[model samples]
Target: MHMNTYSEATTSQLPIPPTMDEDLENNTEVCDGNNAMTPMVRKKSELVVVANNNSRLQMLRNFMTNLQEVFFGTKLVVLFPAVPLAVVANFYSFGRPWIFAFSLLGLAPLAERVSFLTEQIAYFTGPTVGGLLNATCGNATEMIIALLALHQNKVHVVKLSLLGSILSNLLLVLGSSLLCGGLANLKREQRYDRKQADVNSLLLLLGLLCHLLPLLFKYALGGGDHSIATSTLQLSRASSVVMLLAYAAYIFFQLKTHRKLFDAQEVDDDEEKAVIGFWSAFTWLVGMTLVISLLSEYVVGTIEAASDSWGISVSFISIILLPIVGNAAEHAGSIIFAYKNKLDISLGVAMGSATQISMFVVPLSVVVAWIMGIRMDLDFSLLETGCLAFTIIITAFTLQDGTSHYMKGVILTLCYIVIGACFFVLKTPLIGQSPKASFGVKPSFEAITT
Candidate 1:
């Protein structure tokens, strides 16, 4: 389909037949009395391009909209620089400790819960009405959470945020979807793409490996208890590099052989049947992120001031708390979609975003921290590392059962619970120390130091 880029909208001497609507069959529209406007024809491969979509004015308008989301995100908490400034400025501020403690306890959980709730509604609709809607909402939720986590300088928590989401989507969401949907098809048990699933499954497997490898490296070096700096870099670099390769493979495989993964995307045929008003959902997503970001900054600032006084390790903060905040919406959405029989969408949520976070978010965070002169490491401890591997192995094994059941769902949920326990149970391995008694920071340092 060659498009004429001619200046004139209409000409009698035009060589090709007009693409404009030639019939009154269904009230197809004409733009500027020329090109046709089929606003509601839905298909699998294309978008409902508003006749004005290519016009300078419309482009400008949409660009403005997108700018609003970005600016709004930035201004909400000055997400990038705010926390570090707050941390540094604590030196000159009075009552800094009090300020930090109250702010964190009030802010982090509440903002994340909002995102989780908003996304849960969106997810309940499934791909039938809100597949793309859910994905967009998930991104929105993530942005809101990430911005807050970033502002707080809760680096480890943000990482856990990513991890929790990956685990939830991969295991619980996917498992539940397959279980319910597969049972629904008990007559014959319809199967989806095997080759694609196999490849995606591999990528997901590797992504989990990237996450876990960091922990293993840290442990091999006598645990995070030793302050040997190079070890952290080793974990970060290895995870980023391998995970990146796995992701690239996923994209290539998807584009080349398994285009159906994106089959649910809006197109010309189903245009009329589609009901999602994406822009509205996007707005809500952005709005939620803004509020969350503001709250997260305060949360981080307070946490820093209060951490030692509160007798908690920042490690515990990151590994357990951060993941819950960042991925709350995604976890809910994936589970709901699965329960509704939209298993493919569930897979997309789990595998696609898992890859995206491992390849994109982790590296980007590292780069951003570097630019900000933060010395955060994209590494993990052996315990945290083992959880990553456990998630991957369990997810793969469960899915490979070739039939979804409640048992699979139970397995996934249990993994999540066990991992959560580690946050409060496992003692933090500090540099120049050995693994000691189980966690529960004493008023004196004796418990951990021993």
Candidate 2:
């Protein structure tokens, strides 16, 4: 009886099949040949995958936020619209004068933002790299304009613009900085590092020597000789190479071996923070440069037309107006720092810019022109070269004592005014024509009347 009961229990437990609903719910597991249940993998839903992707896109939003922070909230930001306006005007063949005006307005903020971006990058790089970056890109507008003019075979424009940059930074910008600084600090003595001033002065003298040699070569050997022109061109090219080498050495001296001498005047401000990432600053700098190049091309193309329309000489337009507009942002920065009694930064902005233009930009323009098969000599004509020489001499004397005052600033500013007035009245033909050619004998009145 016990054996029969056990057999009945075993038979009952042998197989109880699952219901249809239970089979459907439990189908994720499968019974293999060995009767072992194996689990099957399943994919996530489409909605869940899309949610993960959306989260990753937040980086784009962060970039936009940073970009707005960097570009907005400044008075200059209002001028940004002028950039596109200038582009549209250029495309639609709007008046050349309008294009010129819009381009200048557009360039002002770009130049300022360039400086701001460079400062932001400097936060990551040490001051040495920052100084080098400033030296390279400080006069980028001038360099771009000069290169564009050179490409157009407007060598005269290149010479005038570069000369104007040197003069502007040295006389106008520095003079204004000193003036504002002196007025702001009435009781305190305004002083700067003499070593830095002296080094820049010496470099200026060297650049002057390079410039003067070619002019003297032309006149000393008689300009009537064609060989003299060729010789002057050759001399200018050779001098440009030498000047570039000297500038490189100056960079080494300033940033490496003798860096302490240059850093004496920097104020350590703990409050200053970088507003953008290094890569962001770099990307913006590149974009700004490209925009500047486009505007610069417009400026160069329309300069003569603007001059004709405005009743201004091309020389005046290139020398006085262009520099004022191109360096407006930098000029303001130097003055502001000076007003805050940070004379070191002010001098670095003004004198450092001047030195870079003279030693680097001017020479670089010549070298680039040489490569383009253009004869861009260093002989800046008698009038322009004389002004540069006088400006340098006076500036050297002003900074010789390392002490500055409103009186000194007054003198420098007056000198710039005088130079501007001289250019305003001076009438010269466009590039490829001699200044003396314009003064050639005119036809008799009777001949014209006939």
Candidate 3:
């Protein structure tokens, strides 16, 4: 004979007391082992206890995370669950560009908001939380898109996306920032961020090698499609290991030799006054990213659907369209920074973001794609390779002399605008009305549409 119904006092005393965060706050019970509570109970009771414990543990973990955020910082929120949200959003079929555009806008505010949060967590520790958050969100969005592309076997599209993002950050973000900074002062000179520069250059070199190696290897192997993507993934993993080690070395050098480099960050004094602390802001960011990602996915999906109806190539879409959408937010902040005469920091942001992507994001995507049995190459196509080469060359030229001029900004921006126009009209020059399992450039637009 068992009492199925227990009194409130006894129930509270039972090991299976409710375990919600707020609900647990009221409970006076503490776990003290089998002696303190009944060891043998109904299986249902045991399940209840387990559920409560799990919830309590999660609450504790979140609290600990809050404490860490108080001391440390955070990453991009709108992109935290980008893949999942994108998958859902892609199910929608209209207004995709706006969705994607909204996601792009997420970058700037995310950086600004997170920086404020991290600064607060550190008790105004002097680092902008927004920088890392923006990068994180950017990386997350890139990878999610990469995965979707890979899942669809759009290898060329993936390369285009990578190149487009790099170019957007380099030319658009950097150029706009330089333009603003230059206009504020007739002449703008960049100071030496030697540590950051060295790391950036090294990563860029590594990324180039990752791109070059498999491409050359494939060309040597008669340029067959088979295993080209696979080989690229393997090389990406190797490069990731090398570059990660380099980053570790950079961190070590900063710690041991130039500690001030870690601190003495260049932040906007005005922005700082209005910014909230890290954890408080980060909590809000978590919610925002979710909403934004949802929106972004819808945007991408709708655009894609419309594109499918309009017969647009994903490669052209990524190269021209995605860039406009993705970097919209960060570009605004970069321009402001430039206006505030933070040219060096702007260059660092542009170059640093690209270097990190090439060295870390691309490689990690390869590994993750591999694990998921998706083929993601570490290499780029001829056009993509050409674009990367062009970007690096122009970037080096732009930053080489440590001076940024307004004319240069005009040049870079105009080039981007021209490219955008070409993309819109030429439309990746597709061919054939029917979708082919194996992709080859179609001969003409008429062939594609008909």
Candidate 4:
């Protein structure tokens, strides 16, 4: 009987003890092929071991099942699983610039996954960590594209894209968010903390001013004289360094000194409500970043080709198309939050991203160019500078009252459209073009630079 029990436990895939109970050993014997006797466990002892083994196995299986449910449960897993297929598609279509571009666009959703994971992590870590992570990764796509463009000495494209990013965030994304949120809450006014929003807008205005200084220095003293150009470049490099320091201080003010000012809610709760585990969030962030980097390379490689083939200016490509592509994540998040009536978070996404691009990413590009010996100056064209200044001031004006209506969104969006159209017709930039040589109109230095 004891032998039978041991045999049943073995066949049932339960772990068996090395030795059986002494009572069973005294009572029972097992025989090998040569009729050699071996000690066997008693039936009761074998049953006890089997029961414990089954319990352990059951617990492990349950744990695995839960893990599988959690990890693969999200609808986003559908996209994650397609990443391998996208990679293969990109490789197979390597020679076709259009196909490569299409594949790169497809990879954008995967990059957006990083944003979702960051939000999840933030939910658990609190708003500060979450906001910081979002800010860092928010422009990952743009930063990657700019750095790659810088590597190829495509400084013009980089500058255009930087302005494009800021405009897209300020006008397109923010406008859409406000419209959606206001419409969704049409019965009541959609409001955000004007005070917090104004701080960022002020910072944006400061950044825009800093950007204009290089241009002012160049044109104010006369056209890009070799010595003046040299001075402007040096000044730009210095300004970029200072801007980076200022950005650090701004972050300190927002996250440390006056976090409550930016908090979406009055409660100071630190409880984490995110469902994603730490390991899972970290893994996804790293993986998605790699994918975005690869996709950005393909996008940059094809940008000029696409622009030429489409008969669109490279500036237009960078200013409009590239910003839309790179900012896909934030654009989606902003609209989604707006639809959900989370206007505060929605506004934060738009305003905060715009501010970061202006203060942090733009300055970093200048510093990176200086480091790489690329003669990148912040002397934007008059049209570009004027558009930016006008947009920032108008946006600041809209935010001042703390209330957003769908009509206001329409107005902001219309302004963006007009500006985009002007850029579309803007002349392809000359290497040393005067400020007067712009899109059909020539504004004085005061109007253009200031």
Candidate 5:
């Protein structure tokens, strides 16, 4: 009876189990909590996706803005359409003259764009390295044309075009800059940094010496001597190596040890802000270089046909028209800067280009030709060499004083005009045995037969 009573007491003290209705309410509350968390997680993921899309959109917008600025920032952009036209004309076998004209128009904007891209890049590379970049790329048009001509075995075109570039920079571009600057600042004396001018002049003289030695070597031995021709070719190749080394040294001096000397010609303070990012500028430069190469090929390929159609001598076309057109952008820039009384920048643009062409591009062309098995030498015919010699001497004298006047500009302009006239009337055959053939070397490459 006691055991039964203890069991009953324990059973009475135990709690009761929950009902089905209470259990249903607890389950619904758990389900509600899970449902609420699902929406929050979904919203968070959607926001992340939206942010990613917005970032992509912003990048696309920036790209388009940069593209528009690159393509439409300049007045010359109007000529950009000519690039496609020329391509179409070439594809359809249109007249060579039409292709030539369109290519030239296309090249104008491209050349200007190249300069713009280089300057944009310079914003990141400091003044010294920027100046080096400018010097390297300033005559990119000429360099491309020369390389194309060399590829075609048109050594004469390469020589004449390079020579023309030097002359144009030294006389036409420099003279125009000086004339405009002197007239604009008639009351104030227009002066430039002589140290820079002197360095350029000395380098130019060294290049002249290299050119002269090859020509003299050929002439010193009687014409039609095979041995002499070979020796002259060897001398030219060796001289090219020396000139290249000298140019490298000049680059070092300008960019490293003597950087301060060129600081005076840095980009203007107002113009320091970059129009595009570093990689953007690099992309444009590479793209423009490729386009310039294509247009240059068209130009070199059809030069003779255009010359024939236009009734102009090939020399006149290569030595007069080509340089003027190829360097149009640089010429304009120098003149504009000079007019603003920034003669140092003007001088750097003009003299630096000339010096680079002489000491760098010309020799580089020779080396490139050598590599291609083309027998291009430094023996510019007596006529061309004489013109180069006179132009350099005159230019050296003009820059010696570091002071510029309108009269000095007038003199240089007149000199260019006279040279242009001489070439216009001169009817030297473009297709001939290599200049070395005159010295009796077996003709390895035809000259300007393209």
Candidate 6:
């Protein structure tokens, strides 16, 4: 009954034309806007034009925004060169070691600025290219400092700094990130992907093993004979090449084959999302690298005199102070991300950086020293190697469950403090010198003369 009533109402509302010609005439009137059809079509056409204009404007605005993040963002730190430049000038003119020290310290923020630019570029590109860019210049400040130290033939300092970097990342940076994240989300456990952390741990172990083999060959098994020392050097050289190759392969794994396993989820930071072009980021990366290298030269040149003036050992300067300053940028970044509850990115920055330093920076330093005619072997002091191994083992165990807490962070930090204290009193030994005591006892002048 309802259907029949609705049908009758519809039929009554329709004004049926008596002839086909009359119906055709009425349709024409509607199309020409004698009725509502023409007005509706005009409104739709105007809406399309407005939408097109808005889209083009937005694209232009994004381009401008990217330019600012890439270039202008760097201006804050890039412009910081004036301070270092003056310090360097004062050092040369007045011959002040302190001035030279401060000059390099000033470059720290610039190094961080370069890292930020790469991050912005990564945001514009996908994960693979971002990872590539990051891996390439991952530890710019550390690499530059180590290279300068190697240039001055300060092999002991270089090795200690490497151990310092590894320890700092595995313990200090990772610990701080966990603590901050845990505190940020109190009562909620922070978790990361266990598989990714395990793979990184394994790679770090590989690096430790590579360093360990030469030490075992020279000291433990071969009793530090001259012939054995020579072989150890040869082994170290071979291992450096192998480690570099492995580093390349690992890069392939992270950025290509199993990228998704390690890649961070897309974060929603409005600032990071700023549209920076690839060329712009590349230029800044290269430029910042060169500038940091120049500053590193000045810093290493005065390190010894500064150490003497300040009454600090070269080992302490390199091992503790240098790592903190060199990796300051990435370390701060990781902590910030963790505090914001972005654990994936935080973990990636902390762990990925350690792997890069281990697999890339250490080998590159060895190869560079070799090219410079320095017989820098992989014979680390027993204390350095043992502490490194301990740190790696503890870190692996802590991160295995993929869950983190404030207590875990405290434990890791305490481990770092313990190891750092040990290094503080420890003397810098001539690492490649053989047939000494079990620990890193200083080689006698007779040993050097012979």
Best by TM-score: 5
Q: Is candidate 4 or candidate 5 better by lDDT?
A: 5
RMSD of each: 18.1, 5.5, 16.7, 11.7, 3.8, 13.6
TM-score of the candidate numbered 5?
A: 0.92
Model 3 residue runs over 4 Å out of place are 1-125, 128-134, 138-140, 147-158, 187-195, 225-233, 247-259, 262-265, 268-271, 299-303, 310-312, 425-450
Index of the highest-lDDT prediction: 5
Where's the lowest-lDDT run of ten residues in candidate 5? 441-450
Over the stretch 1-450, how does candidate 2's per-residue lDDT look in tens digits?
999999999989999888998897666444442244222221345567777888777768768866786679356898999999999999999999999999988998888888888877888987867866865676889999999998898888899998998899999999988888898898999888888888999999999999999877766665435777788899999999999999999989998899898777566889988877889889889999999999999999999899889998888988988898778767988999999988888888888888999999999999998899998889887788899999999999998887888888889999999999998887766534553211233322231110
Any residue pairs clashing in model 5, and if so which?
none
Distance from true location, Cα of 35 in model 3, Å: 49
Kindly give the number of clashing pairs for every candidate: 22, 0, 19, 1, 0, 1
Model 4 CA lDDT for position 353: 89
**Compared with the true structure, what per-residue lDDT tens digits does model 5 show for residues 1-450?**
999999999888998788999999999999999999999999999999999999999989989988898899988888999999999999999999999989988998888888888888888987777766876676899999999999899998999999999999999999988888888889998888899999999999999999999887776675737777789889999999999999999988987798888998875577459878999889889998999999999999999999999988889989988898788778888998999888889888888898899999999999999999998889887788999999999999998987888898889999999999998887657533434433444433434333
Candidate 1, residues 310-334, lDDT tens digits: the string is 6766555554554454554455555
- Estimate TM-scores for all models: 0.57, 0.87, 0.65, 0.78, 0.92, 0.77
User: Stretches of candidate 4 above 4 Å error?
Assistant: 1-96, 265-272, 430-450
lDDT of 4 by residue, 225-246 (tens): 5897899899888888888898
Worst 10 residues of 3 by lDDT: 430-439
As for candidate 6, its clashing pairs are 66-275
Better of 2 and 4 by TM-score: 2
Candidate 1 global TM-score:
0.57
Order the candidate numbers by lDDT, best to worst: 5, 2, 4, 6, 3, 1
Model 4 C-alpha RMSD vs. true structure (Å) is: 11.7
Q: Which one wins by TM-score: 2 or 5?
A: 5
What tens-digit string does per-residue lDDT give for candidate 6 at 160-227? Answer: 88778878888998898888788888967677778778778889999989989987776655356678
